[model samples]
Target: MESMLIEKSVQGDVESFEKLIVKYNRYVYNIAFRMMGNEEDAKDMSQETLIKAFKAIGQFKMESNFSTWLYRITINVCKDELRKRKETVLSYDAPLNEDEVTLKDTLKDETYNPLLIYEKLELRSSIENALNQLSEDSKSVVILKDIMGYSYEEIGAILEIPIGTVRSRLNRSRTTLKNILQIQLSEN
Candidate 1:
């Protein structure tokens, strides 16, 4: 079905292109949101990514899955946006603060204690802060592999790096994150 959509889209079928956008919009937006660490920028980046994909559909080779191709585009769009903004650190807490629903509500545990929830939230905040401290390259690798659960090869393809490089960067990122977390805990 995806292949059919891609074929039609490549043939200049507007409806087919729209269908592809509808199918992958959320995935693209999530990647942008995670990379940008804000909703508005994420939405803009996602829209730009889809527009680029639509325009360049003909150039897309069938060697990769459409989703992977889309991911590559999304990453590039984000990198460009980041460069334009000249911003390195991002606040992952922005979206959470704007949401009406609480994490406890989402967890939906009958035995959920407010104190425990507070502790969890604190830990999550610490983790996000640590993540923001990483360099863009390390942060992207960590988010793709650890947060988004992409395979090393898939991340390699997305980031245009070797699989070994992906593994090594991920290891270093994880170590940095762990150290940051430890320091945060000890300080608390």
Candidate 2:
């Protein structure tokens, strides 16, 4: 079914292209959100990625799966955005008072106790802070493997790097994240 959509899209069928976009929109936006760390930037990056993909669809070869190809495009778009921003530090601190319910809490089940929700929020913030400390390459590897659940081979293909490099980068990223989290926990 998707292959047919891709074929029609490649042939310049606007409806087919819209269908394809509808199917993968959330997937692309999620990657963008994780990489960019904000809704505005993620939306911009995702929009740009889909536009570029649509323009280049006619040139796309069928060797790789459509999702993989889209991923490659999304990564490149994000990398470009990151470069333009040139911002190093990402602030994870919530501006609201301590007692205020966070956005994370709203998304989670309401049955949980407030204390448990706060604890989870802290953990999530700590992890995000640690992730922000990593270099872009290391961060991408960790997000792709650990967060997005891509296979090592898939990661390598998406990043255009060797599988061995993916493994080593992932190992180093995990170690760095673990050490950072430990330090955060000890301080708290």
Candidate 3:
């Protein structure tokens, strides 16, 4: 069913392309969210990604799965958006200085228990914090390889870099993340 839709869409069937967009919208949105962080920006990025994908459908190589190619395009669109957003530092990095510290101490909510703390640290939030601390190139490699489950070769193809560069970036991102986590823990 999807392959048929892809074929039709690639052939310039607007309805088929619209259906394909409907089918993959959530997947693309989630990827955008992971890459962008903010909901508004993710929505804009996802919309722009779909528009770009539709525009370039004729040029898509059928040698790869449609979703794979779409995902690559989505990531590229996301990278462009990130670049436009300028340099955003990880919120975790700028440790709460005196005013923030006082506010945190005074307005502490009792909602976050150890279990909740562990759960938050287990997935998206913690990983995002770590990734946000990385250089954009390193962040892109790690997000593609680790979060999005792209293989090194696929990432290389998507980024137009060698697999060795992808692997090296992943290693450096991992090391940076480990160091950041260690620092956070020791400070706590």
Candidate 4:
């Protein structure tokens, strides 16, 4: 079913493309959120990735996984945005927006234990903080393989690196995150 969508999308069928979006939007948003750290930037990056993917759909290889291809675009779009943000300055005087929402906000379930929820949220927040400390390459590998559950081979295809490189980078990324997290836990 997905392969059919991919074929039709490549052939410029808009309805097929929209169907594809329905299947992959969540995955794209997840990657973007992990890469960009905040809700607004993640949504922006995800939108850019979708636009780029739509433009380049004709170039995608049918044998490759659609999720893998979309993930690559998401990462590249994020990397570009990071580069742009690195050079841009933020004004401390700028007003703060009170309406910012997060994925955590949407997952509210009164049935869940409040204590369990607090602990999980704290742990996730710590991990995300640690992840932000990693270099982009290391962060990408960790997010792809560990957080998003992509196989090492899929990560290689998404990042355009060798499998061995993926393994090494993931190892180093994990080590750094572990160290950072330990420090956080110790401090707490």
**Candidate 4 lDDT over residue span 48-146, tens digit each:** 899889889989888887888888999999988887778332222332223433333444564344334448889888999877766677678889888
Tell me the lDDT of model 4 at 176.
63
Give the worst 10-residue stretch by lDDT in candidate 4. 88-97
lDDT of 2: 0.77
Segments of candidate 2 deviating more than 4 angstroms:
89-118, 183-188
Model 2 lDDT-worst window of ten = 89-98
TM-score (all chains, Cα) for each model:
0.77, 0.77, 0.72, 0.77
lDDT tens readout by residue for model 2, 1-188: 87788889887788988888797798789888778877898899999999899889987778888888898899889888887878774222212123443333444554445334447878888888777666567778888887889999999998999999999888877876655555555456
Residue-wise lDDT of candidate 1 within 159-188, one digit each (tens)? Answer: 889999998888877876656555555455
Candidate 2, residue 97: lDDT: 21
The CA lDDT at 49 in model 3 is 93
Runs of candidate 4 exceeding 4 Å displacement: 87-120
lDDT tens digits by residue: candidate 3, 1-188: 87787779877788999887786798789888777777898899999999889889888877777777887888889888778877764332344332222222433663433224445555446567666666566666777778778888888887778888888778867776655554443345
> Ten consecutive residues with minimal summed lDDT in candidate 1?
90-99
